[model samples]
Target: MRLKYYIIAIMALALTACSDFLEPDSISTFDTNYVFSNVDDARKGVNAIYVQFGVDGFRSRLSNNMTGNTDIERQSGWTSSGDRYQIWDLNALSSNGDLRQFWNAAYTAIRDANIAIEGIEASAALNSSDVLISKTMYHLLGEAYTLRAYWYSMLTYHFGDVPNVRLAPKAGNDFFLGKEDRNVILSQVIEDMMSIEEKMLWAEELPYGIEQVNREFTLGLIARIALQRGGYYLTPALNMERTSDYQTYYQIAKEYTEKLINLKDRPLPEDFRQVFLNNAKFVTPVNDDILFEVPFAIGNGDVGWNIGVTVQGGATASHNYGSGNNYMAIPPSYYYSFDTLDTRRDVTCAYYIVNTDFQEEFVNGGISNISQGKWSRYYLDAGPGASSAKGTGINWPMLRYADVLLMHAEAENELNGPTAAALESMARVRRRAFDSALWDEKVDNYLASISTSKEDFFDAIVNERAWEFGGEMIRKYELIRWGIYSEKMAETVQTLKDMADSAFEGTGPYADLPDYIYWKRNESGRFTVLNPNRKIAAAPDDTWTRESWLLGLRNEVTIYQEWITKDWRNYIDQGPKPGVARYIFPIPEEAVTNSQGVLANDGYGF
Candidate 1:
């Protein structure tokens, strides 16, 4: 039987609208006056908030490749001519549809929660049925609030200054304060969510893992937001500019997340692949470790069929059993980093693939042979019996219980710098990945990955995030929060190339670097276009800023231009240069056109 499921991405906050002046307030159309007469309406509203999870996951997954977040350097090839889909520019994104959907959905969710809040305040005591429904109200409302906070935090990280909206703005609501300070926005988000934290239970719903928000999720979210606000507004790695609010967030993160970690069910399962493959033994299931996760369903909405990079006999309607790469290729060094015994290396990327071109065996390229491999299954259809319309049932984890364990470990290490407990926590993940029996004895030996000094320990945690959580949204956050993404990209990409070149010195696989000629471009003005070549000794450490001279040849430049700007400083509270607007996602083109710009929060542009 085919099970149709949907992963509700409720916990989204909007693009902090760039400014308050971008849109005008709508009067008399929608009001909190007659908001909720029943519970289902409120539940649906809560569902809307969850939609942000979808937005976050899809955007994170696609961009992980194109964003230089991962070592998958062939992203430009995936977007080139004759390809299935072309990424024209950085701002023009594969996940834009989700962005558009998310903006509308999040606001609608806010409007619904606003209605519930208004109703709760206005009504009297309820019967038993009403009591359960009331608790649901607070739970969902709290979730909505948390999602709002999460979304806003994400915006502030990506863009910079975003318009902040608290209560739903009706004709009579306070519209005077349109553009609040980023800290002020963070404050409102935290306050609204924290208000309901005490009222909800910290339990995970069944089937879904720990990353799903519960009371524990509230605490974790608090920790995440607090840490981010601390880094961005104050206590930034370089101490660029410190917000008076830094201490507040730092303490909040310490307290709430510590409570979560100290819970009897704290710590993650030692296995690495099970976090993604086995939903039953989920880290959250083992204890309160799983804080929050987005839901996934097949043949549903935007996140439905044929959406990922898996090709050929892949689960999509257009498959002829010969199209698609089966799974996206990975860089060779990525696999080399894995110990032969480490389950994650195989679980994360496929080393090789098999195909028969003329009833004869043909081995073209595999993930290990390439740069980075796609980890998910690429069944052309479901059960090997159904058509492309039905795909293998696999749910991708946007956030997992393991991630929470790491987050707790990271937050703890950040505060104290170096502590055995923190180091032990980090090693627990790696030990399980390699050998569980040796966990207690051999785990202590991993200091080589990071080092022993306090400062070095902190650096180890950052590297741990990269080495352990590579390709996930966490890497970028780790780098930026640690104040090192620009440097790390330049360093790692180059390291990869040099490392590859060194390893393939005598190996036939990389002589003349047949896999790398196309990376080079000739911008010798006389011919301003690329002259294709594939003779690579190793993958080059090419990135956006590094490819300034060959902007047309690289996708890094394509994507970088979409988001990074001379305006990043403007979004910073006290930043000198202009910063990207951080708060709310720009109201999508349809949104402005639909409402004549009267309903948008502000600070949005194409």
Candidate 2:
């Protein structure tokens, strides 16, 4: 409850990713006059709002929280405990430490944004100096409002109806405000973003290599917010779904996503892996496909330390990334779910990697074998010896044009089944996943395979999203919105159990052993781990035999076999039933205690 509501946002304007501005936090009295005295001051004020995106508690934790509890990823290894464990394990209490960090961090960002909004508004009359200055101030103010909307949207999504503080808190003001309806808050956020859509510049209009909050990304935010607002959400107190909102938001989501699709030059990249590689390598010549990314710099603030080596694994014969904790991996079922011909299968999840001996080796001594290669730390110049290796300048893509296309397809399927435009939009994503010549044919065959019904098409969209965005921290939310999180999760575990029940014998990693590993480079230029146990007819040419360890356990239970025998739902905390309230987290105990009865765990009153 000791929320330090101050002018910290304004005081830290000079601490940008690149140090070009001045620091005034040392000054006893913050001269408000100089803070907004010119266009540069206004620009600094707005840039401060974006600083939250790189903070330890905000975007970094957000990515982990969103992805950790899903079907595709699990928290294991050295770094998987404490608050994050509470989130994935599901025994999170109102007193959970991370819940407090997330709540406090979000409100801190929101409070600073309110200050920026007020300052920008006060400087409107002073913009009579230059034409460019006037335009800049307006643009800056627009960003402030859009950002505030974004933070509030996040709060409402994670924790139901939170206090809607539109204005900055003043000394001696009543801070114990009551919770407001999440829908009402989202409505205001949408209106605020709409008000400034035209005033802001697009990513393309900005200087090359500069990542900023622009018009298209803001519109994407709008589409995302509207979709949530219109979709089913647990109500406060009862934790029941708002059944009536789905249709309304579906239309809103479709409108905004379609607008994005129609935008000039906002095309999906031909290669999916290339887009990620560009970000990891820090592509000098920036591409337009990445609508928005959180910028980071070594020695300054960065996300690579948290996401790169931590999320992905260490150096292997297949790739190099110095050292990494293989803390998270996809299940065997998810690995086998992908079509053998699909390019995304190998890139999204790699079960086996070639060792130093140029032989396929299980990752992490086979504890948690699979690894995500989306953001490889080795892609950065920082090596194991570099002190800054942990702080590589790899940015996180919050919104990409590929997501825009998929959203459009999902909304269209919901509204009017599979239309031609929707099919083409979805096919564009598949084209990147497969070879060019057969891409269209694969899309046609996939569409034809699904039943010609809206529900069936939505099912396709659900699976497509999993393949398209494996480790991007999006699937859990998608499952919740569709009201199938529990059902689909049960199926996921069942898939694993079925594989274990059959033992390792049929295909993939379970096939019968012949000793030597079999692998091939897919069209995507990534290594695909084929069946490692395959035996072929050869005359004195082949001499590779199974390792002693593998031969010893020929028909015995393996790590994967042991994994399926335990309770898969152990990922959910010990208690807390899989109810609507369980989908979102509980508000921190201190906040509720300090709210003076103003903030109750209405939806999640467990």
Candidate 3:
């Protein structure tokens, strides 16, 4: 069962609110002594940090809407000039409201965490003679540290080198600050997580389970941020580079992932689909596939609303489930890239929508707009009413055990050239992707092929991540760190063109792929399709309905949709530096105005 700790506890911290982005009159005076004097109040102080996750900044924008234009997940933002479109198109201005919302929310959460951390450290309860009180206090302190690190990690990656505000707000404190190096911020947070993770309890020991941050998640985060610190990043000079001591960070990743695997290990859940179904079903089991997920209440989060399968209905519609649509669509290339027998393919990519009639129907444009199939309100046990669209209450998965295993494999390979340990780690994740019957061919042999060289293994990891975590919205950051964001986007564009040419001309590498698909509901009323992998001369029966598939990629005037061809042009050729993604966004106008000459939007052509 999930707890209402965060929601119920945050109200007490309202009077002690800190200004977003540390403006003057930053911290309103509050009685910190009373709040941290006992274990219960201290827990409330920490819970306030999680309140930000339920806000619009993370619930919709940062989590799903703004993270797009990747090889797998995409949105054609070329036509619209809205705030979200500006972000999707990678040309967000300083005044873009979406960026400002996330920026402000992250800093607000950071400020709350800072207050809790300081209060907990100074609290007399921390050193209480009673074992229970002392242990609980220590755990609360760790929670504060981990939460603060999480916010810093998001801020640095999204805006690049944001001001490092480490102290709790006070009247005399210096609020105005300038950007620090992103590496410095990442390094600091990584160290912060590392310091407290060992002292924190595991998920099973905690009442909230995977719904809240625990030792395992913090340990995994250490490796994750370490890899990010070690990986390539865009510099002020518009160059893609990593620090000379990058290997040190990689070693940190290797050590921490290794530590987690050794001290506390869990097998990847065999049924990948059930992993997400559990989230929608509100069944969060401890020591399972997920390490930590942001626990949004029933009236919060945009999981199924904006990031899952398209559900078309409204207040006046026949169905009571209301409406939801995927802001980011799966590229047909990504859909076809999956192995035909892979179970993850169907679960990760959906070509149908829950229509207004509450019946499954093929998406209007077919291959042009394949929605994410992982989760949807249609899968909910009960509807939230026909007028509902914004919140589905499905928890957003922050980290999974599969990611930990993959990170272990990647870090091991980078440090020691695809060692036996590395191959085993990769194989563990792949083993779950396929069935036991095909393990020898799909898992063992595939691992053997990729283990030929370090480069081959690394490439396999990249492809594996795309297939494993499609629709999860972490692909953009992964590509950036891999220094292949532009290369992959360019490749995706060309692949789309090839797919279009083959379907239009009926003679190319993808000619075997069907131009149109024949689909029908099965006896169980589940949507099924024929010729998903290759072309067929005709449908086997009249029961099947035909729809344009690959053929939909082109029209009379263009080989592919103009949006497809122009989708990543700026990311590939016209960014701040050619062939490099301009990962940094301009500091929000409000933040710049509040900085009092300490900050400006200057680098990366801002």
Q: Which has the greatest lDDT?
A: 3
- By lDDT, rank the candidates, best first: 3, 2, 1
Writing each residue's lDDT as its tens digit, candidate 2 over 129-233 gives 677677667777777887788778778767878888777545555577788888889888888887887777665565533366777787788888777776766
Candidate 2 matches the true fold with a TM-score of 0.83
TM-score for all predictions?
Answer: 0.67, 0.83, 0.98
lDDT of 1 at 273: 50
Instruction: Compose the digit string of candidate 3's lDDT tens values, residues 1-606.
Output: 775544584565553443556562333445788888899888888888888888888889988888888999988878799999888888999999998899888888888888889898899999999888988888888888888888887787778888999988777788998899989999998888887887788999998989888889988899989989999988878888989998899889889888989998888888999999998999998888899998878888898888888888886678988889888999999999999999999999999898888888888667878999998999899989898987778898998888988998998999899999999988988888898999999999999999999999999999999999999999998998899999999999999999999988999989999998999988877788987999888898899999988888998887578878777888899777779888788888899988888889987878
- Residues 544-567, candidate 1, lDDT per residue (tens digit)? 111111121123444322112211
Task: Rank all candidate structures by their TM-score, best first, as comma-separated numbers.
Answer: 3, 2, 1
Q: What is the C-alpha RMSD of each candidate to the true structure, in Å?
A: 10.5, 6.3, 1.3
Quality of model 2 by C-alpha lDDT: 0.62
Name the regions of candidate 3 deviating beyond 4 angstroms. Answer: 15-18, 24-29
Q: Which prediction has more favorable TM-score, 1 or 2?
A: 2
